[model samples]
Target: MISSNMNVTFENLSDITDDLVIGDQVFTSRLMLGTGKYRNLGVAKQSIECSQTSIITVAIRRLQSSSNFQPNNLLNMLDWKSIWLLPNTAGCTTAEDAIKIATLGHEICKKMGQEYNSFVKLEVIPDSKYLLPDPIGTLKAAEYLISKNYTVLPYIYPDPMLAKQLEELGCATVMPLGSPIGSGQGLQNLENIQIIIENASVPVVVDAGIGTASDAVKAMEIGASAVLVNSAIAQAKFPQLMAKAINLGVHAGRYAYLAERMKKLSRAMPSSPSIGFPN
Candidate 1:
């Protein structure tokens, strides 16, 4: 059980004034960690604590069964009080399956406790090799989930049109992938992502294929509301160190965005004072 005094809605960071609003909830951290692919449970927990993210994602299927249940399981390992759990329907390949998994995710959150409230990260991928998100299945599931009033955040490709469609259907957030899942390619479809950001009324989170801290920095700098990184931290040689780096990168990028970075120049302009300096 979560502690009564634990802070779930906020984490103080003076540089950023705008909070990441998903549905009715607001989060201070722009970095959301995925609770998978870590070397060990201890490492995952340490990494998450280091990241200081308001929410961490867990797959719904893993939490439903008691077969592998133990003290080391994700639920027991997580500090449920302070961290918001955004469960994902990771393995579902069809709209129906995704819906079922999402329902289970909501039920699990309800039973466990809803400090931050129940939120579902909907993923429906049929392809195993590339593991790309199924846009059609995702849309179908998102429609159904929204009807049931679930705070649905659909994982999707960097398709601006699709993003607009999902927003129209009432999804809380639209997660556009930077690259293929776990590939570490880093913003392969930057132009499309930019379009999505430009058009989206809701939060646009850069999800998946973030290879390093720089990748995360680039995402937020390009106007993404937040980033969801898993493999970058979990697969790193030092998970905790990587996690801290990610947090820093996220803050730096968000600060840059909020501070309003300088406009792009068509030609080179001298920073030094040419009138005073030797030619």
Candidate 2:
């Protein structure tokens, strides 16, 4: 509910550089929005616009022909041509299921766009309570998808060792969760996240568990390449305004990081000179 803009001076603003290059595409906005939890399509579109996010993620599900809702039919309501769709395998638990979902998503992208080239959020969460990503299964899935030549961005816990393995497996990006999915806990493992950011060779996107603009800012301030947030915005009372606030937060975070923050010292300084003078 709070505005992202506060105490930020954009004097030497960082140019929105195309740092995130997935396959042949590059993204400027580090703030990635999820297409789930919005009450309506109109609100989703508005939030996307406000976020200035060129790439947004959406979850895919099998639609029965007899069902009232449709697959691409719903996606079509949005200006799909303007934004890049990153389909996530949210419900997949096994490696096989994840591969199948990736294949289906590739086919769908082919039908939807001329390039037919978009990244996949390869998520393999077995448990329902914690929604923790299965590192072993995730690596298997990422290896398969990367072999298939699909840009893979696998979401995992903030574990540097796991991140190294996934990066070695040829994932386009390694996305680590701030906490649990939709938990809004926000950067529970700051130390591990810093390690991931430090050692990662690829883009490190902090995904899930962010509850506010400040959370997003904190992630970016620590040098995360990007962030993915859904509940903090979509579940808010004013989704559009929340989206704008998030955008500003991301911008503020980016500016702060690029400024290369000053060093910290332990000693306290006296405002007045310590030297005594005759009065």
Candidate 3:
């Protein structure tokens, strides 16, 4: 399924498809992953290669260039052109900071030959403890990002109405939190995600709090456009193995969506009952 060497087959079935188009970029894969917290750069690359991610997220922070050591010592090891490098404003506390950081990221990506047609994950997490999104700041940042000709993907809480609000503000996609960031809760807010997915015209990418492949499948089962996952795979003991699992999960989820989920069972049909037996 990935680069012609993976021997993969599908089993689950549903009616939803996973092809996501953001601006000029069309992604066939629904599994979006993060490029952070791996044991090492080599392992990270291996995980990504195995995961077959379409979009990979990286967090950016301000470095004290003139402070302690030479700024040239900074390391960014990932190859930008190999994948869609999504720069995230992970620790931005305010809307202004978010806008400024995103603008710099947009320009930087262009310098790296990643093209101006890049995506910036607008995250305005005011709290460090809970990692909860600051909706007010997030909305403000979304508006500015939308006006700046950047494809915006704002990570937000599982508030259906707020997701719609962001969608109305010209966002390319609305990323509702699956749980909390790094919580690994896995569809804890299923009702709200379903609501957002049901109403969104743009892609609804489940952004955070997914623990396993089953969680991703559950998100897709409810019509999510795609799922953005990070810690669940990256923090695993064998990240490469976890990546493959997640990849299979996303593929299965997409295929299931396309094949149509089976109807819920009300009463037992009884394979061998008093009425009709095979014997």
Candidate 4:
């Protein structure tokens, strides 16, 4: 139901309601938050509550480490019964590593009584500095995970070709970076992202490099099906308030997109007619 016609008016778009479908699951909120980089789990919880995101991501490594199993445990703090958990292979650098992490994530989900949906965010970033996803490794891992009955959500660069290939490989959703991970660059590669959104058959989620609410707005306005924000909200001075703002921004941008936002004009066009001029 994603249309780029840009021929409709805001008044007529009031009734247009769309759900974000990833694999067999449907989410009402298009803002997908990550459980990382927050001051603490308390802040993360508050942010999650304010964001109203039905889908939240967690690194499988965190879920596996015994250190996080202590008091104020990350997973223990979350209401797993309510929100959908999307475990990611955040630190994985190879397809094999990603596949292994995804498997572990599925097993953890089973142990935690979350077996209804097994969605894993496959991220294979060999580069430590920028943490940008390796498209080849991602594609390889996605294919393997899909075969193993896991709903793969591949994190990748904003390349339309890679997006299509992932979709073809049975990825549930395609997450393209707006900029580098945690860079706060705000869609530096906007043209590429627009292309990804336009061509993707599955949901196009703008992930990483979102610095603020306006960045989220821009992402959704450019036709992103959803936005995956972590550092943007988690690192904010007031994480809870920023989360709320980001959620609202997503809603606004989504509505604007569905409303067939006004086309850009090259020249000025006065709201008042020339005949009604003061002269």
Model 4, global lDDT: 0.87
lDDT of each: 0.87, 0.81, 0.79, 0.87
Per-residue alpha-carbon lDDT of candidate 3 for residues 1-279, written as tens digits (9 for 90 to 100): 121222345443333334567766877577899866777767887888888888887675642233312433212545555567788898899999988888777765765577665589999998989999999999998888788788899999989889999999999999999888888889989898888977888888999998888898888767787888889887888889988988888777765665577778998775555755466
Report the CA-based lDDT of candidate 1 relative to the real structure: 0.87
lDDT of 4 at 271: 79
Q: On a 0 to 1 TM-score scale, where does candidate 2 land against the true structure?
A: 0.87
Per residue, candidate 4 scores C-alpha lDDT tens digits across 191-239 of: 9999888888888999999999999999998889999999989889999
Q: After superposition, how far is residue 275 of candidate 3 from its true place, in Å?
A: 10
81 in model 3: Cα distance from truth in Å?
4.1
Compare candidates 1 and 2 on TM-score and give the better one: 1
Clashes of 3: 10
Q: Rank the candidates by TM-score, best first.
A: 4, 1, 2, 3
Listed per candidate, the RMSD to the true structure in angstroms reads 5.6, 5.2, 5.3, 3.0
How well does candidate 4 match the true structure in TM-score terms?
0.91
